[model samples]
Structures are given as structure tokens and as C-alpha cells.
Target: MDAETNQSRQSALGDLALVVGTLVAVKQSVLPFTIVYAGPVSTFSAMIVATFLLYRRGLNWAALGLRKPDSWWRTLGLCVVVFLAFVGAAAGFGAIADIFFEDVGASGRFDFVKGNLPGYLLIMALVWTHGSFFEELLFRAFVITKASTVLGGGRGATLAAVLLAAVFFGYRHYYYQGMHGALVTGGIGLVFGLIYIWFGKRNIWPLVLVHGLVNSISQTQRFLGA
Candidate 1:
């Protein structure tokens, strides 16, 4: 292989390794289910390692395109639009499905009777924060960028990365939320992948915030229901 091709291969391999490492860490952590779900330190560590690999491999942070406009208002507006657009779309689709399927997620929606509100809120808050940061770091910043670097700009690589990450993201939920959760989370990953590509690897913080906001809303709803 030529020098450029070899570098691309190495970058792609690094991303794959990062994803695998994160999955393995999630599987092997000794922390209690609640604790691990709440904090997600294993994922945090895995992403840190991924970032190091990217840096060592001379991956460009600028290429990741995380920088935002200088105006706080503009940034906040963009974030709000992105978050609402995605969440609204998901809700609309879910509502439509409810018409035919009898509230598919209603059973798992919120169980306030079984758990106290305070504890649930605390756990959800932690998870929302930790989960968003770790997920974006691993999937968007590392996985998508690495894949793009290797596969070049085209539909094939983008679709491949989205599908692969969606699988992993779905499986990650299976341990906690079961089959439906896996499906929903996988869809979420797919959306994030599209957004990552749309943004040209820059400004992933919006995605991170949007993700956290959605999780926070779900958690709040659950808490209130409880």
C-alpha cells in the first residue's frame, strides 16, 4: 500500500479498536448496574483512549469541526433547533406508530410506582450527562471521522459507520432497557451519525447537548410519573 492508504487504514483501525474497547469495558465493569448506568466511567475512559490514539495518529481536531460561532445566542439557537428537530421527529414517528401499535414504549415509559422520584432523577441526571459526552466522543468524533478518513467522502462509508455504530449502540441498551431500547437507541445513533457528517466533523458539542437534553426530558418525565 502507498503511504496515504496505509495511514487511512491505520486511522480506521484505531476507530474500530476504540469502539470495541468501549463495548468491552461496558461489558466488564464491576460497578453496580445503577452506578455504571449513572456514571459510565468505563465509556469515559474508552473515549479518552480513543482521543489519544487519534492525536498520536495525527488526526486533525479542526477536521472534527467542533468549533462554534462566537455568538452565544447564535450557538444556543442552533443547539435548540437541532435538539427540537430531532426530538420532535422521533416523537412524531413514535406518535404515528402509537396509532397502530398501542403505545409501543408505554410499558417501559415510566415506572414511578417502583422507584422513588429523587433517586431516579439523580441517576438519570448523571447518566444523561455522562452518556451524552461519552457517546459523542466515541461515535461521532472517533468513529465517523476515522471511517471517513479511510473510506473517503461517499455514501458507503457514512452508511457503514452509521450502521456499525448503531449496532453497538443498540446492543449497549439491551443490557439495561431490552429489545425496544436497543432499537430506539440505535435510531438515535443513526441520527447522530448523519448530523456528524452534515456538520463536516465540526461542532459536535451541539449533538452532545441535544442528546443530553433528550435524555433529560425522558428522565424528567419518568420522575414526574413516579
Candidate 2:
């Protein structure tokens, strides 16, 4: 490569490094306060920040897969099919694990519904809106996009980004769900990461919907006292 091309690539990477560093600092400093004081609105702050960063970087919503697809119905249908498949797979794994571990995850996951309408509705709303929205944008879009820049885009880079981000995604859940839930969440994150990569990392709507649906179904189970 020519010096000019190499120089340009380095300059771009430097800019990305700066942006990512600032975001890390901001998250470290601000997230705890938001978690304590903002409740569900913690993610609202993240959404706002992500939007501003995207704008400043001259990135459109297309960066996060907000484009017109060939068929919207096809996208939605695919999401539904993927969601069901994941649930079925998870159930099978849980059953097999149960044989040896005997209720391996019984105490690790969240009970979202709480046996009440208002509380259940609130939890569902948060999962569908903030949790799915901010999480997809944060992890699949921003984190993966920025980190993948270092390795450059290729099959190897995509795989590396997916594995790295998926592990961190599982770590994100470790506090609330413990080890068993963290591992399960990490597996889910790997699938979502692959979906993001498959779509050229330009669209994560399907992943968002799948995540929201999983949380919704879990809440429904809890509501039914299962």
C-alpha cells in the first residue's frame, strides 16, 4: 500500500480510537448515576448519546440497519422463525442439562412477570423498548463496528468481533443472572452477533426483535405462574 493510503487508514483509526475512548469514559462516569437515579430511563440517556455520536460521525440510521428492506414482512417473518428456533433449542439444552445438573438454571434467571399486571406490563415495556433498542445499538452496532475496525472487515474479523462482543454481552448479564444465566445470555449474544454480521452489520432489527420476544415470553411464563 502507498504511504498516502496507509496514512489515511491510520488517521481514520485514530479518530475511531478517540471516539471509543470518550464513550468508555462517559459510560464509566455516568452509567452508575443513571442506574441509581434514572431507573428505566438509564437507557434513554444511552440512546440519546448514541444518536448524537452517530450524527457527529456523519452516520445515518443505516449504520444501525434502519433501511428499507426488499420485503418488510420477510424480515419480520424471519425474526419470528429465528426466535422460535432459539427458544426450542434453549429448552432442549435446559432439559438435557437438567438430567445431570438437575435444575441448573432454576435459581439464576430473572422472574420478570411478578404475578401482577402493572409490574408485568412495565417490565415488558422496558424490555421491548429500551432494553432491545439500546442494547442492539450499543453492542451490535457501536461496539462491534468500532472494535472490528482494528482487525479490518473480513470473515475472520467478523468472527473475532462476534466472539469478543458476545462474551462481553454475557458479562453484561452476570450481575443480575449469575453464571448460568450469563452463559445462556452469552450464547444468545453469539447468535445475535452472527445475525448482525450476516446482514453486513448494517441491520440488527431482527436481533432486537428476537431479544424482545425472548424477554416477553419469559415474562409470560412467569405471569402464568410457570
Off by over 4 Å in 2: 1-42, 88-112, 200-202
What would the TM-scores of all predictions be? 0.75, 0.75
Per-residue lDDT of candidate 2, residues 157-226 (tens digit): 7688788778877766554456665666677777777778777255567777787877787778877788
**Candidate 1 residue-wise lDDT at 208:** 76
Q: What C-alpha lDDT does candidate 1 achieve relative to the native structure?
A: 0.65
- Candidate 1's displacement at residue 56, Å, is 1.4
Q: Please report, in order, the local distance difference test score of every candidate based on alpha carbons.
A: 0.65, 0.65
Error of 2 at 172 (Å): 0.4
Query: Model 1, residue 19: what's the lDDT?
Result: 61
Ten contiguous residues minimizing lDDT sum, candidate 2: 34-43
lDDT, candidate 1, 1-226, per-residue tens: 6888787777677667766676576556634554334326667667667767767768644557656645657667768877866776576545544454332353442454235767676657665656677777776667766665566646887778777776777666655555665566666677777777776365777787787887777676666663
RMSD of each: 3.9, 4.3
Clashing residue pairs, candidate 2? Answer: none
Give the lDDT of residue 22 in candidate 1. Answer: 65
Quick one: best TM-score, which candidate?
A: 1
